[model samples]
Target: MCFKHDRAVGPLIEFFPRYCIMPAQIISGSETAKAIREEIAAEVARLKTAHGLVPGLVTILVGEDPASQSYVAAKNKTAHALGIHSEQVTLPAATSEAELLGIVADYNRNPAIHGILVQLPLPRHIDEAKVLFAIDPDKDVDGFHPVNVGKMMLGERCFLPCTPHGILELLQRSGTETSGAEVVVVGRSNIVGKPIANLMLQKRAGGNATVTICHTRTRDMAFHTRRADILIVAAGVAKMIKGDQIKEGAVIIDVGVNRIGQTESGKALLAGDVDFDSVVGKAGAITPVPGGVGPMTITMLMKNTLQAAKQAAGIE
Candidate 1:
């Protein structure tokens, strides 16, 4: 059921009773992330001029996994383009957990490297947790360190997990008010779901929303989703949330990137968790799959690296 406007969004509607279909405004993460990168570039230039410090980032990849290599390469490219000193360390699949930990320790003590990121999905023999825990919290720009997680929970100053922070940036940059909004996040992954939910519940500019997280255990998913003013879907399933499942004008942020098929030329066709075509006409605003949350993740990691550099130089 549609409701008439109670707030001053614009002039009153002149439509017939009971229904109106307005297409959702597309929230382009590519555009937003580009704008942010420009801003980071300027700050990087200034940091060099005044403080004579170059923000440095180092990414460690454990294996030759094609997808991981692609992601790491993209990150290195972006960091270089943004004027941040970037390095990528590649190791064989047979590299032991202890060796990886030792490498992390070397960077942790190296003042030249402000941010250290270990590309995930280490070899089966390597203990991923041990490697992650070995990096110093200050240099843990991926924000997966236990110390950083604890600080985030307390609302203290720390590097936030990249994807979650990116989602917040997308919402705030799009001028979506969250102070009293009803936000329903679908997923429970430590990477996206848990952190994003906590961020929206904090008492801050991009936070203070009433957040409800739905997981596999959720009895009535539609019941919670239909009531959300802002719906963030990261369940990892392809086109899981359909049009009729959402409220009339809810803002949708799709974090899932599933390859449902391939195009004629062999390019992969991607879709978000929220079915874009099904939800477009009813949603107030929505993000597209491949271009939505995907671009912002690495950008936020760059942001964290810059912040880490500033902190190391004692420059706020």
Candidate 2:
């Protein structure tokens, strides 16, 4: 029952020393999404009246990954619904790195466009890191650029990554108490795992939580997960964690988006890292996959776009 390192032992002992199931709230994203849209619409209206121009979000899609295409399409549709102008630049799968970088540069310089996001998981032939670095930090609404990442790490003011930021929003809107809680983030990716951990452990709002991050190499993942008051799974595995793995009453945030085998009709189904049906009864709170973290991601993008606009226009 002891971890090798004292840093690990300290938190493990101080928090999650006992396992007990707590009452959970299953938050559907529809209500959250509707409220977010209304808030963003109000913000947009205020910005337009104050600055005389609306914020614009430009998304660059290089290839035709069905999932990525659908995501971008949804983003565009959501932007319009929220009264934010959206522009998408679609390029062939064969588009070179230079071509993609050039497009990002154009968006960076365009005064009318306040935010620029390059759809992720670029073709294998392209260097995603190089392409991401080329985007100006001011216009990097996706917050993947190293500059923004560093800023977030240092606890400085900067654009937070969409998914992590969305997770914070979800927890906040749900009235979850982050301070003094034991939060286990089950991923190490810069996008969700690291950023979220940083956010939860910060000294400000949504911070002050003790955080532990587990990954493929981590020993006894369940041991750590069951101890967490707030369990965030982003491992990209389908139903990898089961209800028995979590303590009763633990708050679960499923960030995984995995497409499993087709149904009897040959249509694929989506699932989260946690087994929803199994965990629902035991968890005090849990987020469903398709409607949970997914929708919040795009909503955060809209927020970042509006922030980028205000920053670029010196409107605070």
Candidate 3:
């Protein structure tokens, strides 16, 4: 099957093309996140020596969902690698909402704990809203607390949702000028789309961009996308956006990670929302699925945890 789309434009931006002989700049999320982690590590060392403080992250995991368990483990491992104090609280699948809230309450008052993260999609019996709000705003490293969310919208210094904050770092660090640029975000989930769009509209570096959000109900997705200087596709549908929908020279960030199926030998395979092969030729800098945005999310969580630690220690 041919991957090329009929729609044509100016010279190709040649972004990160996967398994293709192309000249695009592959934005390596691992590289970007590694650099940021190094900086965080240095800061961690400074905090320890100067103030005898080690930033701490507490993860609350409920049930045995394989994917969630793996994610929490990765976060725990990364926190320790960076010298951040890490704790994992695993509860049975049948744990009550009150019990979980009680755990949050305990961590909130604990001086040693700076960041509290509750792995999402809690058991059906738990009231997620109650549990989310139960976390002290300063310790809500996931940025899901109402206080942090409101503060972010108002352009205050608060923990940003990890994925979106990481995406912003990718753009700024990669030298993509967001100021006055036309940006189109393809998803509207509170996690990725809404927060990213709000970040773009902010008066900050990697922000101040004109943003348009396209979701399932939106008409003319391609038309909006083709006008973007920066195109972010977070729609969960696998390879949903094709090359024909992209604008040449547009920077593509693939935030969607979906399991398409098994590979030829039965290994699990993953794909992004954009048809990367088709869009790769046209993008300026593209983030490859699995290697791109995925790594940055955890790195940003570390950033948030460090910040939370700073706030608690009264470190300006």
Candidate 4:
């Protein structure tokens, strides 16, 4: 069956199997973001009232990349809204490697700092892997530390990267089944690609999905995507996959964040890897950029922070 959301010019058609037609929640990004913030706020209040513990997050931004600044700002705003203590350490683009390491060391030793995230795409001068390694694994909210990554790979309970965890939460909360399904993840970046692929293949609840990972090096991406029961695209390209590339009744999870110029206004707008207009008519369900994966990332970050706080307090 097809679902249409009418617009001024025409109806936006989306298809799903007839049995799957129970009015699916739109999963509004704004609404979910607000609810997650409120939930974290309540949890923080409870923790403080019972244990006098306040969750703390520290973010280090090395350069003034516009996108990085905006992302850090949003993180700060959300932390405050949730009554969690947060601090941002801004450094010059030319800051020395030793200086960055020193900042991480300080946060590492600070008992109050429950979580730490060094913003991505650090200045070209600094070694990104070295900085990530310097973060104490316990406080690595971004989950980029080798320790956490290793733990995840080994199927141990640990803080997971926000984006991947968010995608999992989105699928679960939406009532999508993953067990034993054919899941194709397009992209192999350590952050969103590899970790997610590992998570899906784990032998656990909400996992055990047969996963295929595709990358630029893959011979035929469309062939893999077309057969996916759940297709996750994180290739960092704009509308790289069209409707015909996906199979009917497949669930599409877009992890790419691309800025493309608008045709009419010539201004830039955000888009995902999958062509939403085209694939919506073929996929069983699809996540829209700006709303789908973005909000979940922040929510999962809060969750990791809360977990860290609990660990620090010996409550978990």
The candidate that wins on TM-score is 1
**Where does candidate 1 have its weakest 10-residue lDDT segment?**
9-18
* Candidate 2 residue spans exceeding 4 A from truth: 1-23, 264-267
Give residue 306's error in model 2 in angstroms: 0.3
Which pairs clash inside model 1? none
Residues forming the 10-long window of minimal summed lDDT in candidate 3: 9-18
The all-Cα superposition gives candidate 1 an RMSD in Å to the true structure of: 2.7
User: All models: lDDT?
Assistant: 0.92, 0.88, 0.91, 0.86
Ranking by lDDT: 1, 3, 2, 4
The residue-by-residue lDDT of candidate 3 on 220-239, one tens digit each, is: 88999999999998989999
Name the Cα RMSD for model 3: 5.2
> Considering summed lDDT, which 10 consecutive residues are worst modelled in model 4?
8-17
> Per-residue alpha-carbon lDDT of model 1 for 165-275, expressed as tens digits?
999999999999889999999999999999999999998526899999999999989999999999999999999999999998899999999989999999998889998
In candidate 4, residue 106 scores what lDDT? Answer: 94
lDDT at position 137, candidate 4:
93
Instruction: Mark the regions of model 3 whose C-alpha exceeds 4 Å error after superposition.
Output: 1-22, 264-266
RMSD of each: 2.7, 7.5, 5.2, 5.1
